[model samples]
Target: MSRELFYNSQSAYEKIHLQNALIFELSKVTIPSIREIMVGQLNFINKELAQKVAAKVGVQVTELEFPNQSLPADSNYQDLQSEEREAHTKLSAALSMDNTIKNTIKGRKIGFIIANGVNALHVQDLKTKLEGEDAVVEIIGPSMAQVTTNDGSMVTPKHSLTSIASVAFDALYIAAGEDSVKELLMANNKPHVLNFINEAYKHCKAIYFGEGSEPLYMNSNISLKKHIDPAIVSWEDETPDNKFIDAIAQHRVWYLELERNTQD
Candidate 1:
C-alpha cells in the first residue's frame, strides 16, 4: 500500500501515506487492549500524529477503553510486558534493532581495553575505522603510561583499566593483554561484569572482542540462546566480518523469544 501510494514520490507525501498505513494497522488489531497501549505509545512519539491518526482512523478519544482497572502484581504484568516486547520484536526483522542501522551514531561510544604489551597499532586502526564512522573510541590502558608496542610506537593511556567500568560505554572493544586477562580472573568480579554484559545484551548494546578478550566473553552457563541470535555473543575481531559489524552498528538483537510457562 505504501508502495502504491508513495513510491518514487517526494518526502512530503510520506506522512500522508504513513497515516493511511497506521489506520490500516489499527483496524486489523481486533483486540481493544492492544489498541489502547499502541495509541498511547503512538501519541507519545507524536501528539499531532496521535490526534491526526486517531481521527483519520475514525477512533474517538472517548471510545478508548481501560478494561482492567487494578494493576497486576509487578511479577505478573512486568513479565508479560517483557514477553510481549519479545513477541513484537520477533514479529519481523523490520521491528528489530538487530536488523536496522540508524544513520545517526550520535551518543555512540566505544571502549578499548588494552595493556602495555599488546599491539597498539591494531587498537589504533580499529579506532580510526570507528571514528570514521562517527563513533567515539577511548583507549583504556592497564595503567597510565606510554606503552611501547612491538613496532616501538608510544601508545598513551586514556583511562586506566581499574578505573573503567562496562557501564562506561555503549560498546566495548577489548585489546587486553596477558596482564589484563590475569587481572580480570584474579579479581574476577563475576557478578559485576556478568551483570554489565547481561544488561548490555538486554539493552541492545554492542560488544567487540579480540583473542585476548575472548576469555572475558566465554559463556559462563548463562543462556544467550534464548534469543536465537548469534549477534549477542562476545566476538573475535581480528577476523572481522560484515554481519557482526553490521549487527554491532545496529546495536541490539531486537528479535527475541522468551521461554515462559503456558497460561492456564
Candidate 2:
C-alpha cells in the first residue's frame, strides 16, 4: 500500500484501490484490552483512547492524576489544526510501542575465555545451563591450539583471544581452575585476555568470573570501578549462575556505564 501511494505513475483508480485496501487492513486490527494497553506508558492522547476502550470492555477506568511534563507548560492541544492533531496521535502510539521491553535470553551469544588446565566441570556446568536456555556458547582460547583441561581432556576453542574482540559476543565468562588462570596470566596471553575483559566491561556487557578466576578480574579495568556493578558477577556471590543468567536477560547495564568506568 505504501509503495502504491508513492508510485508517481499510479493511475487515479489504482490510488483509490490502495486507499481502500489500507483502510480495510486498519479496520481489521483488533482493539487491545485495557490490560494490554495499560502495560504501555500512556500520554494524554492514548489515555483518552484507553478510557473509551475500557468502557467498551466493561472495565472501570481508574484516573491517576499526574502532570504530563512531556509537552511544554504553555502548549495547548486545542490550538493544533485537524491534520496536526492526527499526526500527534499517531506519533504517541509509535512512541508507546518503542518503550516496551521483551525479556528473554534465547539466541544470545556467550563467550567463554579459557586456556590450558581450565576446569572442565566449570566449563561444562554453566555451558549446559546457558545452552538449555537456548543461548549459543563459544569457547575462546589464548591461541588456535586445543586447550587441555585439568582432567587431561582436550577442548577445542571456537575463537582465539586475539582473533575476536569482546564486541563479537553478548557476554563473557572466565571459568575456574588456578592452573588455567595462571596460563591465562602468562606474559603473552595476559594482555590479549585482559583486553577482551576490559572491552566487555566498557560496553556494559555481563562478565562472570568463576572461582580461581579472581586474579583476572582484579587485573582488568573492572577492578578500578568506584561502585559495584550488578552485571559483573564474581565467584563469592551465592548462586552466581542464576545471577549471571538474570543479568544477561536484563541485557547491558547501561545506566552504570559511567560509574563502571570511573576510578575510585
Candidate 3:
C-alpha cells in the first residue's frame, strides 16, 4: 500500500473507505489457515491503520526485516529455499521505488493548444526545451489541418481540439498569437477550447497560458478563482516556461483540488 493513501487522506470518511477496501481485498485471499503476513515498510503512519484492517480479516501483521548480510558470491539461486526466495522477492518489491524515482521529466506528455496563426516562436521554444528534457510534446489544434504560424510556417497538429480531451495529456500550454487566440475563441471552437482549459484546471494539472492568450484565460473557469495557483502559469509570470516545467514534474496539485473545483 502507498503511504500517500493513508497520510494524504483528507477525512475520516476517506480513511474508513480505505480500510474497508483493504479488508475486502485481504478477505479474498483463499489460502487456508493464513495466520500472519509480513508487510515491509510498515511504519508509524500506516502501521496502526493497516493492523486494524488486518485484524478485521482475522490476520496478524508483522514487520518484514531486510536481510543484513550479503549472500555468498558463489551461492546458487536454484538451491535457495522457497522461504528465502519469497523474502528476496518482497524486499525487491519494497525497494523498487527507490531505484525508479529520478529527478527528470522524461516521458511526460505535454499538449500545446493552438490554431492557425499560432505564435511560432512560443511554440517552438517551449517545445524544444521540453523535448530536450525527453518530454513527449503533441500539438493540438482546432483541426487536424496544417496550422499556419504567425511567421507563415506550417505546423501539423497531432490532435484536434474536439478529438482529444485535456485528460489525455500530463499538462497543457496555450500557444500565443493574437490571431490564433481569436481563432480559438471563434463561436465554433470556443466551447471546446474553454472546456479543455476548465477541465485541466479542475483536475489540478499544470496549464501555461502564453503571451497574448489572456482572452481565453479570462473567459475560462480559471478566471472565477481568487486564489493563487502555482500550477496555473500565466504570461505575467517571470520565466513561465521554467515554472510550467517544474509544475509538470510535480504532477498534480492534488491538495488544491477542492478549491479549484469549488463554485465561487
Candidate 4:
C-alpha cells in the first residue's frame, strides 16, 4: 500500500515535470492557507527557480484567491493530485518572454518545407524577417539546392526532405504547396505526417504554419488544444490561428492543472 501510494503521489509531480507546472504537495486535509504557505516556502528552497519563473509567468498562485476553499473531506482528491502535478510541470518549463525576447538571436535555425512550383516570395520574405531577428533560415525540398517558385524564380533548397528531419529545426515553418499538401495526405504518407507532428510535439518545439498546413497536426496523439496555447508562456501569433507557438517553444505544457483544468 505504501509503495502504491508513493507512486500515486509521484504521478502528480511527474505530470508537472513532463508538462512543466509547479505546485507543492499537501496532505489531503491541508488547507488552502497551507498550500499558499508551501509556495512561499519553495521560495527559500529554490529561489532562483522561483524568481526566474515569477519574472515572466507570475509566481503568484492566481487560482487560490478564494477564501475558505479547501478540498472536501469526502473528496476523492484526484483533482488535488492533478492540480499539484500540473504546477510542477509549468514551473520547470517557464522561460520568460521578457528574457527570451532580450537574448541574441544568432544561430536560431528556422526550416521551411516546400516543393517545386512553390511561392518563392513567401519563403524569401519569411527568411528575410527571421534573419532580421538573427535567425538562420534554411529551405528543405525535393532535391538538393533548388525548387521552382510559383511566380517563376529559381530558388535553392538547402536540405533535402529525406535529410532534414523535423528535430533538426529550432522551429519549423511548413509551406507545402497544393501538390505537396495533397501528397502528404496520401495513405502511405499519413505516417509521415503523423510522425512529423509527433516528433515536434514530443520535443515541445515551435511550429509555424503557412496556409493548408492544418492536416499535419490533424492526427497527432495528445490533445492539440492542450499544447495549442501553453499556459506557461506568452506567444504572439503573427497569424490568427497559430498563437500556440510561444508555449510550444517553452516546451512541455506542464504536469500541473490550472483552474481551467478543474472546471466542473
Q: Give me the runs in candidate 4 sitting further than 4 Å from their true place.
A: 1-104, 142-145, 186-190, 220-227, 230-264
lDDT, residue 183, candidate 2: 92
Give lDDT tens digits, candidate 3, residues 25-50: 76787662442342222332367665
lDDT of 2 by residue, 48-141 (tens): 4344444434444544343232456677744542332323122222222223463778989999988888989889999999999999999999
Error of 4 at 165 (Å): 2.2
By lDDT, who's the top model here?
A: 3
| Candidate with more favorable, higher TM-score: 2 or 3 | 3
Against the true structure, what is each candidate's TM-score?
0.49, 0.63, 0.64, 0.49
**Which scores better on TM-score, 1 or 3?**
3
Rank list by lDDT? 3, 2, 1, 4
Encode model 4's per-residue lDDT on 1-264: one tens digit a residue: 221232234334343342234432233324655545444444433444344333434345333332223568876555554222223232322233222342344566767767666656666766776687667888876557566777877777788755657788776666635555555556755565556656765555556656655555455542445433342212133542224333333434333233224435
Clashes of 2: 0
Report the Cα lDDT for residue 155, model 1: 77
lDDT of 1 by residue, 1-264 (tens): 221222223232334445556877898888776666666556544455567567755554433233232466554543343221322121233432333455455557877766556656666777777777787888765567766664666777787655666677777665645544444444434444455555555544566555566566664223534434544434343356333355556554333222211112
Specify the highest-TM-score model's number.
3
Indicate the residue-level lDDT of 263 in model 3.
35
| Order of models, best TM-score first | 3, 2, 4, 1
Question: Comparing 1 and 3 by lDDT, which wins?
Answer: 3
In candidate 2, the residue pairs with backbone N, CA or C atoms under 3 Å apart (3 or more residues apart, or in different chains) clash, namely: none
| Residue 127 alpha-carbon offset, candidate 1, angstroms | 1.0
